[model samples]
Target: MTIDDHKSHLITLGKFLKQFQTSNSVMNSDIPGNNKFFEEMNQKIDSAIHHNGWFTRENIIFALQQWSEALTPRNLKLWLGEYDLSESGDKTVGIVMAGNIPLVGFHDFLSVLVSGHKVLVKLSTNDRQLLPVIASYLMHLDSRYENRIRFTDNRMKDFDAVIATGSNNTARYFEYYFKDKPSIIRKNRNSVAIITGNETKEELEKLSEDIFRYYGLGCRNVSKLYVPENYDFDSFFKAMYKWNPIINQDKYANNYDYNKAVYLMSEFKLLDNGFLMLKEDESFGSPIATLFYEKYQDEKELKDRLKENEEKIQCIVKKESNTNEVTFGQTQKPQLWDYADNIDTIDFLSKL
Candidate 1:
């Protein structure tokens, strides 16, 4: 099959995904194979929720919605236009997905396949239910995909190159194991927001989505805040009121309570809103139900510090910044071309 063939299959899969864009799924009759696949897809969503508490229905649907928007014919063309896929080498690529959020490693999977390479994927135990169903849908759209996509439960071998995402510890293992091969081994990284005192309330409200989406499980979620010294957090906490319902989830509330207790016992100062805790910390990666923050006296110094530590950050959220800052509320809604860790997946796959 040609590059257009792979693109067409993905476009069809995107149409199927559009049906489940929201928790209240509405099947579209125009979608091919919808009658056979729609019900099973919904069933798998339920199974994913049961298997991993973090995979909530709303979050799963949110991921599907983002992908549906991303996989349009125009979006795909614009994204792939920069590369010459016709000359892309046909090698087998192995992908190790991270289950931190629903469909987290899909872009890498899509990259390998669309770049004219076969993919051998090892699904994270926490995210196993969804992507294979997607693969099945693609295969149903065209038989050729059956030969190109494969998932493994055991050790993976026979791949020319690999892309793996995991914690800092596992990243070391991936680096050593794939040292002889071309690979992209991703380590732990977090996103942060620079809170100017003058941000509109609307922007802060939108920033709440960046903090609370997926209950802040995704690496793209804003885990830290850099605010000016003596900045009042009244407006910030008020803006975050919309996500108060998130605390109703047992797992989140338990974390909030436990972390709050630990902070109190340790005599650390904190700002509490009954659902989320704000603690002054210099770290980028914060624990769930808590947001770490640091007081920045100078904007220039803060940017320089962040730039120096780019390896530890996945994204920066700010307004009117010249650097590669993600707009507020958009950390989770990255475009198809927005490569993670600033690494180009297509470029890596094309080289392989």
Candidate 2:
């Protein structure tokens, strides 16, 4: 199919996604195939929550809402405008999806298809319920999509290249197995925020979304913080209180209680405000219900250190934007062009 044909189908998919932007799935008769697909999509949302404890209705809807907002005609045009897709080749690209959050592997799926390639998907068992229904929606949009998308439960084969996302351990296996093929093997990466102690309470409150959304499971979540030495957390703690209800969720509460007990028994120093705990740590990845922080004495030295360790970091959130730094609250709300790991997915696909 032509590039315009692909864009037309995607824009329709985006409109279908708009109906589920909230937990209350309102029917939009203007969207095509709503009579057949809308109710089924709503049922699958609940099924996703049933299958995965972390897939709460609120977070699932939030993710859908973000995608609905992103898949506009303007966004599609702007993102694809830079590329020359007319020369794009048709290859079967194998995708190994990660299930940390709902639809986490979708961008790779979209990239392969939009850039004129067939996709062979291996869905993460935790997230198997959602994307198939989405693929069904696209197939409804156009029968041609049926030939473009394939989901496999068994071993993957007959693909010229691959894009895989996993933990550091699985990354090693992917690197070794896909050695001879063209690939993008992603490893564990975490985001961090820089608190200069000058942030407004409003800004910090927005920052809380970056910390607690999807219970901080996604790579875009800010798992660590860098604050000035002797930084008073009184305001920060007060701002975070908005999400106190997050602890009421059984899974999150269990993690909070268990992590707290371990810290107390080990006699490790911690900062607690009922729901979340903060500890001074040098690492980037922090466990759920806990946010690791380090005191920075010099901005220049810390920036240099962060630049030195760019591979381990996914995003650097700050009050000011410089190069790749995302503003507070926008980490999870990446635009179409904001590629993961600064690696251009479309550029990778165009030449394949």
Candidate 3:
């Protein structure tokens, strides 16, 4: 199929996804096989939750909705506008996906296909359900996708290039394993938010979304805070109160209880709101149910430190902070152009 046809098929697939989100149940105006597709995807959602404790319904829905928004023709074209797809040829790009958050590796998968390359996806055991069903949907939209996508649980082989994401330990293995191939091996990274006492309650409330969404499983979630010395957290805690229901989940509750106990036993000072805890820490990889924070002497000093640790950060958030800094609470709602690790997957795939 031609590149435009390929793009149209994905756009249809996106429209199909929009039909299945929680709040919107209505079928699109004209889509064949909608009933069966919706039913099957719903079943996959249930299976995914049963397979992984962290795949809660809310998190899955948020992920699906974001992809639906991203799959529009405008977004797909805008994201790929700079690249030339004139020489469409088949090359297999192997992807080792991460299960940290739902569909976290989809951008890489999309990059491979839109660049006119075949994809061999090795799904994370923790995320075994969602992508295959989506792949089935894509193939149903157009038979060409059937030849374009493949998934395997066994060791991956016969791929020209690779993209893998995992913790720092697994990252070393990936770097060594794919050393002979053109590859992108990602390491653990966490996001942080900078607070200046000037933030309004509304902005803090939005920031709570960045912290609690996906239950802090995503790298984009704000696991650390950079605040001025003597920063008062009273207002921030009040804003975070709305997410108290998150603690009601058994897994989250257990983490909160366990982490809180560890901190107390170690005599570490903490700020707790019964659901989430904040501690003064120099690290970015905060424990689930906890947020680490550090005092910054001033904005300039914080920016300097952030620059020094740029590789460890996925995104930095601040309220009208600067051109590069994300607005408060927008960390998770990334656009198609917001490449992970500041790496352009399309450019990587295109040049291959």
Candidate 4:
């Protein structure tokens, strides 16, 4: 495929997706009617709660939109190639999807598809519906894509390259099993923030969405905070209080109780003011109902700490230094150019 071919294919896929998005029949009927998808998703959310204790539909929607936006022809060309479909040979790529969050592995799926390689995907039970639905739409646009893609339940073998996502512990297992092949093994990661005193109440409230959305289960969710010690907790809590409706949800409440009890039983020192927990920490990731906030005396110290922790952090949402405007929810809205780990996925695929 040439660069033109790639662009044409992407434009077609994009248009197809947009059509599917508006088509009531496809959107409403593609998913199983027996509540199977919901049941499976609920079960996955339950497991995530048991392990991490938070989940939200907001994160899932945010992730899907980010992916769709990034799939535009212009953006896809930048990551893939300007107009070259020079084959990297007959590459069979095995992708192991992660069920930690909904559609967590779509990026990997897009990478494989855009590369024009055969993709054998092992669907996570948590995300069974989304990928198939997406593939159905893609196939509707171009049957060629249907032939290139395959979903499997069997152990992957005879693949030229592999991409797997899992916890830090499971990553070791993936490395051992797929060591002989070229692979990208993704481990667990989380985002954090540096909250200067200059932020407004509205900003803090919006920040609450980032923390609570997806129950703080996503790698992009802000799990830690950096604030000045003199920063008043009164205003911060007031801003966060607006999101109290989050706890009223049955699933969120279940996770809240489970994690809250665990924290109490473990005797973790919590900065509790009735609803949320704030703790001081050096790590970027924190448990749900628990947020880590470190005190910094000056901007230089805060910048230094951010730089020191740059590799571990995914994003930082803060107010524009000179301006009073808040940039809170923007962290989750990644552009097409925002390649994961700053690695050019198209370049990686072209070589495979």
Candidate 5:
């Protein structure tokens, strides 16, 4: 099949995804064989929470809605326009996916297939349920994908190149294992936000989403904060009130209790809001239900420090702090082109 053929299959899968969605889903009669697929997906979604507590209904739907909005004909064309896929002949691309968030590795999977390469994927045990169903729907859309898509729980072999995402230790293993081939090895990274003390309740409220979304498990979630020295956190804590409901999640509340106990026992100062804790710390990887904050002397010095530690960060979120700042509240809503770690997956696949 040609590149357009591959795209057409994904477009159909996106349409099928829309039928089960709550927000972006529509009653499109044109999406073929969606009745069975839609009902089946609904069952899987209902059971997803049992499989992985992090796969909440709302978060799963959010992931589906993002994909549905992204896989449109126009969006796909715009994303793929920069590359010459016609000359990008087929190769076998092995992918080791991360299960931090639902469909976390779908982009790499999509990139490999859309760029005319066969994909051999090892699904994260935490994310084992969803992608395979979507892959099956794609194969149903066109049987050609059956030849191109494969999944393995065992050791992987017989692939030209590899793309793996994991912790820093696993990343080192990937580097050594795939040293003989072209590869993209991803490591642990966290996101941070810079507050200028001028943000509106609306912006801070949205920033809360960046913090609470997916229980702050995603690399894009804002795990740290940079605030001007002597900045009052009254408004910041007030805006975060919306996510107070997250404290009801058992896993999150346990972490909150444990982290708060650790802080109290150690005599570390903290500002608590019943649900979330704001602790003055220098680390980027904050615990769930807690956000680490540090005071910045000025923009220049803070940006310099951030620049010096760019490798540890995934995205910088702010209202107007820097040129590359991702607008507040958009950390988890990255577009199709927002490459992880700014490494171009499509470009990597195209080269393979």
Candidate 6:
């Protein structure tokens, strides 16, 4: 499709999303009868939880809005560039979806759609419902999209290119399997932070959203902290305590217990007032209920270390530091201009 065509497609999808948000009465039902979209989203969220018993509807909506905003025509054109519909098309693109977190595969889906390529999406069992629902909604807005999209339980070998998302371990298998084809295989990654100055309670609360949202399963979730020596942990914990409701969910509680017990048995000193854990380490990523960290005093040394570790950190949340723009709960929520690995999707598709 041409750039115009891609833009039109996104506008149509956005309209459909807006309509869905308007017409559906079950979107965000968690907050009582708030808004139609929220209610509908809440229903889907509830169903997803009932089916998988893993994520909350709020997190799912948060992710959906993030993608929807990113895929807006203005943002898409900026990040993906204008599509060239006149260019020769690739045969098909095989997308292996990852279900470790909700809607993690949508960016690739948007790329396939805007590029006018046939997409054969192998849905992750953990996220089998949302994609189909989204596809159905898109088809309602533009039936043309229907012919280009396909969901399959079985893998087919005929494809011009592939994009697979998985853990660092599974990426090796994907590399071997799709090595002959042009592909982008994503391995596991986690985000981190550098705390230098005093943070307001609001900022810390928002940071807590990034830390606890989706139960720390997402790549953008901050799993590690870099704080100055003798930093007062009490202030940070006091600010973060507002989100204690996050632990109320049974699933999150289970994760907390499992990890906390393991740490205790291993003789790890948890920075806890009976809720969360903070440990000191060099790694950026950690499992739920625990955090890893390193102490830094010199700003130059911290910046150098962060630069060295850039490849491993998807995001670095910092206060009064020289780095990328930092936001609190918005870690997982990327804008349209935020290109993944700084690669322009449309440019890549056009080349293909």
Q: Output the worst ten-in-a-row residue range by lDDT, candidate 6.
A: 25-34
Candidate 2 lDDT tens digits, 1-352: 8888888988988889888855457899999999999999999999999999999988999888888889999999999999998888679999999999999999999999999999999999999988999999889888988998999998889999999999999999999999999999999999999999999999999899999999999999999999998899999999999999998899999999999999999999999999999999999999999999999999999999999999999999998869899999998899989998889999999999
Q: Write the per-residue lDDT of candidate 6 for residues 1-352, one digit (tens) a residue.
A: 4556657656655543442332242333332223423334445656776677665666666666666666576776666554455574655888998886777788888777767788889988888767776776566556777788888898656789888888889899999999899888887778887776478887787888878877888887889988888888888899878777867888778878898888889998778755578877666778777778778889788878878866676777765423464667678777765555556655666667
After TM-score superposition, the amount by which residue 264's alpha carbon in candidate 1 deviates from its true location, in angstroms, is: 0.8
Model 3 segments more than 4 A misplaced: none
Candidate with best lDDT: 2
By lDDT, the candidates rank as: 2, 1, 3, 5, 6, 4
lDDT of 3 by residue, 1-352 (tens): 6768877887887877777665546776687557668878888988999999988887898888888888888988888787777674588999999998889988888888888899999999989899998888888888888999999989999999999999999999999999999998899999999998999999999999999999999999999999988999999999999999998999999999999999999999999989999999999999999999999887887899899999999989988857667988788888888889999888788778
Q: What total of clashing residue pairs does each candidate reach?
A: 0, 0, 0, 5, 0, 15
What C-alpha lDDT do the candidate models reach, one value each? 0.91, 0.93, 0.89, 0.67, 0.88, 0.72
- Candidate 1 wrongly placed segments (more than 4 Å): none
Error of 4 at 321 (Å): 9.1
Model 4 stretches astray by more than 4 angstroms: 1-63, 77-89, 265-267, 273-275, 321-327
Regions of candidate 2 where Cα sits further than 4 Å from its true position: none
Deviation from native of the Cα of residue 160 in model 6, angstroms: 0.6
Estimate the TM-score of every prediction: 0.98, 0.99, 0.97, 0.80, 0.96, 0.87
Tens-digit lDDT string for candidate 1 (1-352): 7778877877888888988855468989999888889999999999999999988989999999899889988999999989987778679999999999999999999999899899999999999999998989888888888999999998999999999999999999999999998999999999999998999889999899999999998889999999998999999999999999999999999999999999999999999999999999989999999999999989989989999999999999986545578989999999999999999999988887
Best candidate, TM-score-wise?
A: 2
Give a tens-digit lDDT track for model 5, residues 1-352: 8878877877887777766665444556778877657767877787776899878889999888788878889888888888987767579999999998989999999999888889999999898888888888888888888999999999899999999999999999999999998999999999999999999999999899899989999999999999998999999999999888898889889999999999999999999999888899988999888889999888888989999999999999998545556988888888888899889998888777
Clashes of 1: 0
Of the two candidates 4 and 6, the one with more favorable lDDT, higher being better, is 6
Q: What is the lDDT of residue 162 in candidate 2?
A: 97
Worst 10 residues of 4 by lDDT: 19-28
Error of 2 at 53 (Å): 0.2
